[model samples]
Target: MLTKAGWILSAPASVEDVRLEWEDGSPPGDRFGEAKARARRLLPWRTGAERYPAYSSALVQLAGRSQLYDGDLYRPTAIAGEANGIRLRFTHGRYFEHLDTTEILAYEAASRDLAGRTPADGRYRRWLKDPFDLTRRSTGLGTVTLTIRTAAGSAGFYMHKRDADQLAVGAGVVHAVPAGEFTPSDIGLEAIRADFDLWRTVMREYAEEFLDLEEAYGRGGRPLDYDHDWPFGSLNEARESGGLRLYVLGVGLDVLTWKPELLLVCLIDGAVFDRIFADMVTAGKEGTIIAGPRGNGIPFEFSNISRYVDSENTRGAAKACLTLAWRHRAALGIVSDVDS
Candidate 1:
């Protein structure tokens, strides 16, 4: 088979259902930084920042806005699962270093080491024995959610067209809506403790991507009061009401950067979805909301699933998510109007 490279170790369970465990591990020294430093000494004349100035600046702006925080994010250090349950082990990882190695690859003519390997070839992922290596690189754990609106007999899902200028990876591509890197809602230790949960991270993204709420949630120097906040409060209440259903399909790695993603699906009753997202925006910080027939969600039928899964433009993470969702549609209670 002419196969494409994907997840290094994908379990039968999704990240959400896993019995997750974590170690508050300290920073693993940066492999990319060491390489960059070595390059600075070996061939100081040609530097990444100097050569890729435009791309570097855009990344700089993204980091400056705290969108790419240098703080700790959950790293899936280990995984063990079966048809019954999945147990995942995690550790604290440096958010900045992950971007340094992964996102920086998108820039044209990025750093090439003494051996003449460039970022185009994923030289940053060299430290690990494998592309999904966890040794020196800060392997990130992000979330990708496929939004399905279950409006009684008719059910469909929503997608997003990520803006090219938004970030380095997965940019300018169509992806499932409300996808994001897992991070704390605010700065400091309190947020670190509170936002550590996977569901919290997913809900926060919904607030940001769905409602177009300001991304700077923790700028006020206080942990996000999810119980008191607008979208967060409403989101929690809706979850309790059993109107919104969140499911995780599995996890996968990017063939390019080697980062892992927690693939998820948000199945919401059409009325509940509409009421909660009454003020939903068409486009915001992430990208434009892609609609389906007559501006509704793209049908969740077999044809639409096959169309996206077969399309080259759909992000690989999305393809995996949609493929898995379609496979388990009956389990997820997805009521398709057309053929299965």
Candidate 2:
């Protein structure tokens, strides 16, 4: 079986790693101020429609197969030929809709019926009880799990439980910062030039979560024009200055959703991490960083992330995800051990 973390695209053939620094006119400072201000105005995160909107196109089905290049010979399996997938239209940067439990219930019924008649391994047969993870891991829905690293180490974030979230009400989970669904906006579309790029989703989440630019910009509901020299410039600045290094660590399933999560590790210069961390701490102390409504935002330093997991504060699935990622600390540019 192909290991989930084997499909790392950290360095694609066409990508060149260049050191970038923002000089006189850049987004970090005076150079790209106008553009940053403009892109901030373009955010539409919380404005999702209540009803299911139209997809840009019809769903497309394809054969599903898993592959990994780890210097070992591979043989195709019968399951590879039997499995298939359908591409659902993107959420288009809208807030995540509530997970419809209808699918889970149906899968459970089908699995139970099959289990009664078939002779299968206990592990495979028992999966009917955990329908959420069974569908997530087996069906291959995609997600993005971003691990934020700073000089002090990786940063931890808290998720506020909401109706839309999978966790139970009043529960909290400690997660790597800015983890979210990989959207078409992250990849780019012909109709929307603004969101067209691989880094769009990651950096956009960074801006919204850490920078608080979304609420700040969406405050007045004021309309603003597009500024071409946008998010990319700021990203370039981060990459060039050695403040940020993004890696596609590999793919893994969220234990709860059983969805395919694209593991992305983001390393931030220690100084940059400290600055953001301190600011969030200040925000939390001032009660400016609300924890509810969407899950209050609680920030944790890299050194203390283990507390949540050990204390059982985080959900079981998130705990599994974090534990798996922590095993790759050195690869993710993290220097400390998982427990430390």
TM-score of each: 0.81, 0.46
Worst 10 residues of 1 by lDDT: 1-10
Considering only N, C-alpha and C atoms within 3 Å, which residue pairs clash in candidate 1? none
RMSD of 2: 16.1
* Residue 336 local lDDT, model 1: 78
lDDT of 1: 0.67
lDDT of each residue in 211-328, candidate 2, tens digit only: 5444211222332222323443555676777787765444443443334444455666656555544434313211232232222222333444465557554544344445544655
Off by over 4 Å in 1: 1-16, 27-58, 61-71, 105-127, 217-220, 293-295
Find the 10 residues in a row with the least total lDDT in model 2.
73-82
Q: Candidate 2, overall lDDT?
A: 0.35
RMSD of candidates 1 onward, in order: 4.8, 16.1
lDDT of 1 by residue, 24-137 (tens): 654355354553332223222235555322223445553343344456667666555445545556776656566554444333224454347664454333434464445445
